[model samples]
Target: MKKKNDHGVFAAVRMAAASHRLLTVGTVLCVAASVAVSLLPPLLLARVIDRLTAGLPLSFLAVLLYFGSLALEGVLTSAQESLLVLFGQRMTHALRSEMSRKLSRLPAGTLAEQNPGEVAARFSGDVDTVEALFTSGIISMAADACRIVSIMGVIAVKNTGLALILLLVLPLFAVFTRYVQKRMLAAQLDNRRAVAAVSGQVPETLHNIRTIRALGLEDYMERRYDRCIGDSYAAMERTNFYDAVYSPVVLLLNAVVVGIVMLLSASGNAQLLTLFGMSVGTSVAVINYISRIFAPIESLGMEIQTIQSAMAGVRRIDAFLDQPERTIPPARREAARGDVEFAHVTFGYGERHVLKDFSMTVKQGEQVTLVGRTGAGKSTVFKLLLGLYQPEAGTVTIGGVKVGDITDRERRTCIGCVEQHFSRVPGTVLEQITLGDPQITGEMAKDAAALAGIDAAIRALPEGYDTVCTEGIFSQGEWQLLSIARAAAADPAVLLLDEITANLDAETRPACWRLCAVPPRAARCSLSPIASMRILAAERSRSGAGNNI
Candidate 1:
């Protein structure tokens, strides 16, 4: 499980080990007490049988001792349950906190490689499995082990021969559990994959909800979801079958072992009144012990299942975190001002090159425009400038500092980007602009929103600045304006505007064009656009086909 420092499974194990101490001590005590009390019933029954057969008058002291043991057992069982709950809650709290911390430390693109549904399931489904690890794996097994040993001591110390036969069967139990796990592992992984496939589909339906509504694709999405669900069911059924087969076989084996031992005791002329040095009551106690041991062995199967699920989650999280982000030369620097230059920079995600040795230079304070075909890597230029993507060959620099060299904090603070598909955030319209920037007070937000021709539209909301608008209700034009408002709030040194004017109304185009074209602070950038008369006249012009936009 150990890979690099970044892929440390020891970190996760240490997480489990160090979470809480009181819960562990409490659970151990709880298990010990419960196990001790449970063994009492068999002894009490043996006492009543022995006493009655002897024709001795029933004594009040005997009745009192039996009833008192029963009452103690009842009380201890309740305490055990309470402590188990505490153990589960504490373990979950630690797990969730660690998971959240790990998530925060990971860089962007971590979730890009994973399905959305699978990510969501980590908190819900993955944590549930972890809970089982603490409950069944820890507490249940501990109590079962205590019962097995204590009862074995009773039987072996009293009658060595009968106890020997029972003790021999434990290896068979271990072998059987191992075999069941081997059979179930592959089916478990298949179930997890089917779950992730469903999660990946949810965002597609949400993002393209309008297209689905217009073309009546709701039924199509439902069918797709149904198919994923069916696959998941098939995988679960396989896992269930493994369990169903395992349980019956184990039970049959257990019955055979105990039946042969009982037959030998009855026919071999061995004394039933005592086992080794212990009384008949203790021999019966050993029989009770065997029954308790089988339950943990059975329960261990489920714990193994939960463990397999948790291990799979750990592997996925490890894979996602271990993947190296795009790297740059070791000596990187801070962005001073956006004196941008792209020198024959070539880049690609994988296989397909998006930017083919792209070259462009914008002098300090110069506002240039990139106009190109729909898929002509125009936006790719801005992604490079913002330090989101690195070039494969050559360099992209800002104010003499290589874009690759810029520290993440400085890079984000220096550049502002407004994507074409910006989503309207929940809360008031002001939130869509300010995004909780302490310096971007209410008045500055309105000024920026007004400049983008969205002030009136924002004012029409019931709470105006405070009205909550969640999900996908904003028109494309409204989203464009909101993007502009957000860009201005950052007060960035370099601005990136991607098709912000495409969805605007005809009359609003000119104002929107000027708002983007005007320089912010000493910020100088190459303005990329799909189409705009202002950008075309100011940034690009050709006698033949003109700019591609």
Candidate 2:
């Protein structure tokens, strides 16, 4: 599978944007309307302040107008928030659906690199940042623009010279914002990476905790976790520092701009600058305008940071979705009848050849086993048959059909295999036999369990057929028999058993092999359960008896 490029991230964002189009437009309009309504109160307050020295009738009217504007702003702001929440929900739903569908189509190996825990975090933690783009980003910038425009326009109407003086600081603010933008972008990306690293590490640590304690490496594992968290802290600090430094700086500089505007307005030498002196109302309104401009600049920084992380997360998720999966064609297939053949087949993992011109054939239904010295590709042949790897040269076939022609999904359905390290899953006795195949009913499950010679042990448990055989209680031989039982439940035409007795104690070997002889039919018969077990033990107990004929 290939790692997605920047183009892929853009594509994913575009897809999300498209899916959330109506919501996106609605949120934008709500923010804009909210901003316009919120701007009105401060302008009305300035008017009331400027006109307050007049008598009670005028003052009372001003008070009523100012309070009314406040009420309208409140109503509009609430609507804005409601729309943002609705849109956020819609976007989240679309993003989650795409991610889930991608997981289904992606190959097993690609998903293996990104464990379930990390993938799960994207569904939860990563999508969380998208809210900033719609809510914080839209609302903050819109209100700021509206307030700044309203304040500036009113000031311009009263005195254009004072407005021009305030406008001079805009370029300086832009330069400063651009300076913080680079550090902010890098820090935000780093923070998201750190978050994903922590996400991946936590699950792995728990999964492997047993190994950590077994080798007296608990301290070592703890130190590793500590290091990850420490790195995450540093990344967060770097991210927060940019946000912390920029907002205060923007505020302070805007205050300086206000002071400059104030001095110009108050001094008689600048009488031409404004028709009105620096009245309390004028000072408050000018200060309010400065406050509004600060928001646009400073909020832009926060929005940029949030968007960078969301974009980074989108990149990873897009990479996962876009990556190739095993790369077999849709038309690929092979005949699956257990007539195995290998013809000058050569294969390797990287540069090291594992199979060297391997060639052989077995007739249909023939029980053939490969025995060789260690590292002689004994299991490789079995792996090759099941479509785990493709040949480097020549071909492998079943029923004269080429192995590479078979898709992995199809190949899997046609083969039943028990691996060397077959661990028993945590499940009831019946589940262990059926391997969660609901099609294999209680009767069939018992039949398969009996064939694997696990029925007696299962029946003896605290709950017959329902007993959960898990580690720390059940022995290795019990798990091996359970593993065999799982394979038998499938009713496979050809069963592949590899190293089934690798972990069993010597005393349990004969009984384990004897149990294999009790085929599925034994379970449905009138013979006693132990009777079949006894027959298996007796046959293997005698000399010159082995599993293969």
Tell me each candidate's TM-score.
0.83, 0.78
**Per-residue lDDT of candidate 2, residues 1-549 (tens digit):** 434442343444567668778876777777777777766776787777777644324567778888988887788778877887776666666667766766676654456556676687777776777555555654555556566677677767755666776677766776777777777667666766667777877888787888877899888878877876787788778878877888788778877777776776667774554444566776687677667656766766676666666666666666556666565646643445546678999976567888988888765434444545566776777677666666778887765666657655455445556666665666777876766766677897777677776678888888998877666545777776676667656555445666566655677665654554434333222111122333332443353221220
Q: Which ten-residue region of model 1 has the weakest summed lDDT?
A: 540-549
Local accuracy by lDDT, each model: 0.66, 0.65
80: Cα error in model 2, Å: 3.0
Error of 2 at 288 (Å): 1.8
How many angstroms is residue 305 displaced in model 1 relative to the true structure, after the best TM-score fit?
3.0
Candidate 2 lowest-lDDT run of ten: 522-531
After superposition, candidate 1 runs with Cα above 4 Å error = 1-13, 16-19, 56-65, 213-223, 268-283, 324-335, 404-413, 471-473, 510-549
